[model samples]
Target chain A: MIQAQSLTKRYGSKVAVDAIDFTIQPGTVTGLLGPNGAGKTTTMRMIVGLDRPDSGTVLVNGQRYQDLRAPLREVGVLLDAKAIHTGRSARNHLLAMAATHNIPTSRVDDVIELTGLTSVARKRVGGFSLGMGQRLGIAAALLGDPGILILDEPVNGLDPEGVLWVRKLMRHLAGEGRTVLLSSHLMSEMALTADHIIMLGRGRVIADAPVSEIIGQAGGATVRVRSPQATRLATLLAQAGVTVVNLEQDVLQISGITAAEIGDQAAAAGVALHELTSLTASLEDAYMSLTKNEVEYRTGGTGDDEFGDDDSDTTDAAADAAANDDPRETELQEAAR
Target chain B: MSTPTTLAAGTPETLADIGTEFVPASTPTGPHLNAIGIIRSEWIKLSTVRSTIWCFAVLLVVSMGLAAIMAFGLDLAGTDIATVPGTDQARFVAQASTFGVFFGQLIVAVLGVLVVTGEFTTGMIRSTLTAVPKRLPALWAKALVLFVTTFVAGLVSNIAAYAVTVAIANGQGLHASLFAPEVIFPVLGGALYLALVAVFALGIGTIVRSGAGSIAVALGVILLLPVVLQMIPATWATDVLPYLISSAGVSMFGLIQFAQVPLDWTVDLIIVLVWVIVSLGSAAVLLKRRDA
Candidate 1:
């Protein structure tokens, strides 16, 4: 478990990470989400004792990182993928780190094979591509098999297969009752992988909740209905608090209601339903809403409307198509089909 | 792109299967992280880099190779020491044999600076500090490893140079005893001087934390500042010049004394040590207080 209490950091006049408190419990994967320059990296660095906090304390398993008798065995950290001497080969790099903890060489080879870097383990790191470098970084993080893993942007440069592998690996690690905290700007990946997420904006935690709760809170679940009598269903679904958007002559997107409720109402009205599917607001939509005002660098006159003006039909169609393309939403669609 | 059969066959069904076999059946009982482990880790880090190997190789060749050339040059000159007044034959021979110290010390100094600054330049310091989070142990380990390696290399190079110089000088009838105080002191002292020069540079590297900046500062202090200090036409300037790093190094290595001002070798060693202590002390403070 990692606990950060009132952790704060500042450089000159700029406050990088404001006083923030968070508790990352074991047996779960927690995603730290933020825009560029939102202090996610700084917070992770503070936890590993790489950066001194202006005011606050971070403890890993109830002890400061520096005070741990066997740091690598307790907390594994990968702050930067390229933070290695490129002159050394992958095996030698892991060997040097393992030597500090008196970890045997066999374990080094284990991490090499586990990360699927066995082919190039003997090659110098300077020749590694970005994806290979990230793999090597993960290999190093797993050298000692620490209980707490802190990775900053683990999926920054990974192939689709590698991305899927990391998702499985993180879930596997958390399933083993270990604490995993990773930071990423890829909202779709986080939405699919993270059990819980901590959202940061302008050096503060803007929102913190479970994945389902965050998506639910952004804009509650909406149902997409396709019925032969869609026009009548739209009229019937339009109520005091429900919003029904007519996409096509026979398709209606209804929000502020559940899919079961819509189905029941359509059946009662004698409307033949062709398609009725529930859609959760994409994490991108939820994140944009939570941090639209908190973005540090904004082009002027954008007016904080991520999906353009509400009255523009072109933009509304575009937003709907984009939301439907989300991997999680697509998975839901596939499961429904 | 065939997957390794171990992982390809679904052997690692869970996180427990991933690295469980790699873990020792029984954790080593006593403290795994100690000074010795740190020293070993530092030795691996220092030896694994090609640049470090190249630097040491250059130090050995330049020091010993240049000494041989100087000895031959002196033999060709055929200086008659008996007729020349105020000529100490042993001191002259020792100086000629270790003339390469001037060039060799620069290489050692550069090696010292690169020992620490290289990590910072390549961003390896993050991985290093993450392993040893107390921070001081890493610094101390680097210092220890650099000191031992440079000291041994210096000793071997100086001895080889002395042997070659003596052999070349013997053909010209200038005899020098290896056991003679004058001959032995300078040979060993030259090695000591090189080692200390390296440690001083390591301290500078720690404080500067930049390869170019540290090297420039080290060279400026060891070479430039002394020359700049000499231009001042004052007694204090002349007195202080001998106390500078280069002058003290020369004196400690048993080179010709500064005619106007002479300091005991012990005093020179003390002065050189003060430079190391001040540089390393400040580096330790900043390293602990500042963000990586």
Candidate 2:
């Protein structure tokens, strides 16, 4: 288990990581989701003892990483894939790291085969492609077989087969009661791989929740009404205390109402609807809606004040308001009230 | 309760319970990277690189080639032996074993630079430090490797150059020191002198952390500053030049007539000390302070 309390890191005039606190529970894969320049790399570095924290402390298994009797056997990290010497072979790289903890050479060969680098184990790392390099980095991480595994961007350049292999690998590792903290920008990948998600933006923890809860709580219900009577249906829906946003001239986007309720309302009012569909957020939409304003980056010409803190997208706020009236979003609704 | 049984099985042992009940790591301690292991690692890295082998071979060829050429020319000239100033046997013969020091020192110094700088350029410093994060031990191991390799090679060059110089002098029917205080020290001193200078260069490589910067500074110290010092008045320039490691340090081995005003051997050793210890100390401190 890794616990970071009020962790912050600053480099010169720029703050790379703000006071972000989050815990990585054992026996699960905790995804650190963020865009580029979102302090994901810096925070990971601090946790591994590569960079010193200006403030706050990170504890691995109830002790600071630096104080661990044998750090390699407690926390294994793969910060950079190209950190190996070009002249040295892949086997030699793992050997040197293993030698630190007096780990056996047999274990070294086992990790080499586990990562599927046995064929090229004797080849120099200078000739490796990005995918091969990542494989080598994974091999290095598994060198000590530590309880906690921290990897930064483990799947940057992999074939489809390699990608599936990594997804299964992280899941398998976590299932064995190990703490797996992985950071990546790929939401779809995280959607499949992560058990819990901590979304970071502008160096702060903007959202932290379980994977199912993150998708469910971002928005409860919104109905897409497509009708020849779209305009007339919009006026009726507005009269019924439902907010309607015009998605297209023919399509009426109705929020604060269920799809079944909207269909029933339209039927009673004698409005002929061509199509009616409900939109409950995917993990992608939840991620975008949560990190819209705080994303730490924008190319340009996009309206900047994207965080309005309105609608059902504010999961905690929406979940809080539903407790008294809706009788849904349970477990959290009571605690929140 | 079931919890008490679980706690007894799971808790790690204290240091007092160390050999009798538990051995945490493969060794009782953590990592076991001593000076010997580090040196062995460095040697493996140094010898496997093709550049080290080529540079070492060049130093050998160039030094012997230069010595044989100079000895041949001096014999051909036949500059009358009766005149003490013209046919100084001590001065001419001693120059042979020491002639190649300058050219050989440059190549050896580059090897020294690469010893630390290659780790940075190739991104291997991260792995090197991760294994032995204490920092100074890596540099110490690098210095030891370079010092021994360069010194032993220097001794070989000295012996080879002596053989050529003796063969040429014998052909010309001239006598020289097969055993003399002046002759032995400089030949052996040339070996010691170049090796220490290379070790000093390796330290600078660590502190600068760039091959180009370290090499430039080393060259400026050895070659440029001495020449620049010449522009000063003769009295001041001469005094200061002899105190520098380049000028003062070399004279520890070089034989000059007793009448000549050169620093004593002890003074040269002191100058060498300042260069070696001071440079090495700064390298170690900067390494510990910075990120990997």
Candidate 3:
């Protein structure tokens, strides 16, 4: 188990990780979800004692990482794929790390095989592909068979098969009552693999809940309605919490209400509906909406020009909702991948 | 380790079938991090890298090659072999045997800097620091391993150089026994100085995390500082010349004397050690406080 209390870190004038508190429980895969600069890497570094926090403390297994008798046996951290020395072979790198904790050579070979790195283990890490580098890193982390595993972007450069292997490996480790914490910006991957998620926005915990709850909390499902009298139907569906967006002359995207309620209201109001559908919100949409305000480097496109003309405070919310379809957010996530 | 029966039954079966194949990790049964394991880890790290091998190879070759050249190129003209006294003859042979240490120090200095800075440049220090999060043990281990290995390498090269020098000097009718105190002391002292130079470089490497930058600084202190001080032509510069690391280090091995009043070899050794202590102490302080 890892517990952080008011942990904060700053680099010069900029705050890298603001005061944050979290407890990662054992026996589950907890995903750290955030944008690129949301302090995910910094937080992980502090947990492993690679970076010292400006204030407060982070405890791994009820003790500071520096104070642990055998840190490698208590916490296994894969900070990055390139953490291993490039001059050394993959096997030699693992062997040197194993020597630190007095871990056996058999365990080293076991991790090498476990990570599917037996073929390339004898080769220098400098020549390995990015996928192979990731495998070597995972192999190092698993060398001591630690109870807590912290992997930062473990599947960043892996192929689909490797990605599947990591997901399964995480689940398998967590099944044995180990604490598995992995960080990624890929909400879809986290949705499939994580039992719980701690979402960060500009170094602050924006959402902390189970995966299903996080998905359900993205304002629930949205309803799409196509009618001859789209404007009239939009007015009929309007309420205190309802949000209606006009997609075209005949289509309306309505949220904060159900399709059944919209269809019943439209039929009662003599507004003939051509089509009505309930669109469940995916984890991707939830991530975008949650991090829209927290993106460090916002991608520029048509949204800026649209938001420029409407400088009024009242139109800001409506303009932002329209800018959601700008596609730049998807591009940013793709760029991160 | 518990069985994964429920884990296999719960998740959907995929083509990889990775869930069933996964074996849970057991608790680590081995002894925790200790001094011996850390030192062994550092030895493995030092020996596995190509740069270390290349540096040590260059050191040995240059030492023997320079000794042979010095012995062969000596002009013993106009003086009969019987005219020179035994102590003077032994001193000449000892000087010839240890002449290569003047250059060997530079090679080992580079190796020392590379040993630590390589980890920083390649991001391997993060892995090392995470493994030994107490931080100081890793530094001490690296220093101890570098010291011992360089010492052994230096001793072997010095002994070989002595043999080469003696082989050629004997042909020129000048003889010096390897076991004599005048000859053997300098040879052993030269090797000790080389080992100390490497450790001194290790301390500098820790202070400057970059490979190129640390090497430049280490070489500058060992090779350039004495020359720059000599060029100053000042009383203070002359007075401070003997205390410089390179001057005192070379003198400690009876290879050269920079001071007008030659210091005892023991005093020179102490002066060289003071430099090492200062460098390593500062390195320890910065290493313990800084983020990895």
**Which tens-of-lDDT digit does each residue in A273-296 have in candidate 1?**
999999888888877766655552
Hey, what RMSD does candidate 2 come out at? 8.1
The candidates, ranked best first by lDDT, are 3, 1, 2
Candidate 2 lDDT over B181-265, as tens digits, reads 5566778888888888888888888888888998898777877787788777777776677766677656777733211476677
| DockQ list for all candidates | 0.31, 0.21, 0.36
Candidate 2 lDDT tens digits, A1-337 = 7778789888897888887787676678999987677788888877866667889887766566655655667666877788777877888878766755567799999999999999999998899999999999888888777777898888878788888898999999888777889987778888899999988776777678888878776555678889887777776766444567666768877678889988999899999888899876567767776665554234444554364322234445434443233333232222222
- Show where candidate 3 strays beyond 4 Å: A221-280, A296-337, B1-29
Worst 10 residues of 1 chain B by lDDT: B1-10
RMSD vs true structure, all candidates: 8.9, 8.1, 8.4
Model 3 Cα lDDT, one tens digit per residue, A203-238 = 777777778777775656788888888887777776
lDDT scores of the candidates, listed in order: 0.79, 0.73, 0.84
Instruction: Tell me how many clashing residue pairs each candidate has.
Output: 0, 0, 0
- Model 1: fraction of native contacts: 0.52
True contacts kept of 2: 0.22
Candidate 2: where are CA atoms >4 Å away? A61-69, A99-101, A220-282, A296-337, B1-36, B76-94, B163-184, B234-236, B255-260
- List the pairs of residues colliding in candidate 2: none
